[model samples]
Target: MIIQLLLIPALVLAVVSSLRSRTSLRGQARRKILAVLTVVAGVLAVMFPNTLQALADWTGVTRGTDLLLYALALVIIYLVGSTSVRFREQEARIVLLARQVALADAALRHVEAMQARSQQAADQAPVAAHRGVEGTAAAR
Candidate 1:
């Protein structure tokens, strides 16, 4: 009886934590519905432990606990696979963004270098003109 009571709060905490951590509205809603269903199922399990055994027997499983364990394992595997896929996708996006930033920085540096060269040439123009005048006057 104590174990059954403990399961309720444990399930509630797990669901609450999962729900709070979700970033998307759709995800949260889906989680909320699943959580509600899970809690209801838990309650039903506590109220009628024999039902699990009945289900196990109907499904050709030897034991209810084994059935529960199998289901839990499948859920964990799915979550791990999905999380890995999301991580890879996020990593790819980060790499692409980094490359774009680097390209933009390189273009900016090239433009600045070109501007600096033009300014240096402009600064020498008057000196060149002065030298030409001096040479022409000396010739006259």
Candidate 2:
């Protein structure tokens, strides 16, 4: 009873917080709902050991504890797999973002270089014109 009292409100708050978040609402709600349900199920299983035993008996398992352990192991494996997949997806997004940043930087540098070259050419044009006038005067 104490566990449910503590966990239920905490899980509800988590779901509420997720709902308020700016992320994709559907995904966040789905994940939070799954998490709350999993916790509730675990708490129910712990509270009613007899149910676990009955389930084990029906499934040909010798002990409720063994069945519980197997179920936990499978849950752990699934969570790990899902976490790994999310990590890889985030990694790929980071790589793509980095590429975009690099390309932007390169383009900025090219523009700066072109501007500098244009300024240099403009500065030399006046000097070249003055030198040509001086040469013609010397010829006269």
For model 1, the superposed segments whose C-alpha errors exceed 4 Å read: 1-50
Q: What lDDT score belongs to each candidate, Candidate 1 first?
A: 0.70, 0.74
lDDT (tens digit, per residue) of candidate 1 on 77-108:
54555466567767888999999999999999
Query: Model 2, range 28-137, lDDT digits (tens) per residue?
Result: 67777768988997998989999999877876778889877766655565466556656777888899999999999999999999999999999999999999999999
* Model 2 residue 117 distance off true place after TM-score fit, in angstroms: 0.4
The per-candidate count of clashes, in order, stands at 0, 0
Q: State model 1's lDDT.
A: 0.70
Task: TM-score for candidate 1, please give it.
Answer: 0.62
lDDT of 2 at 30: 71
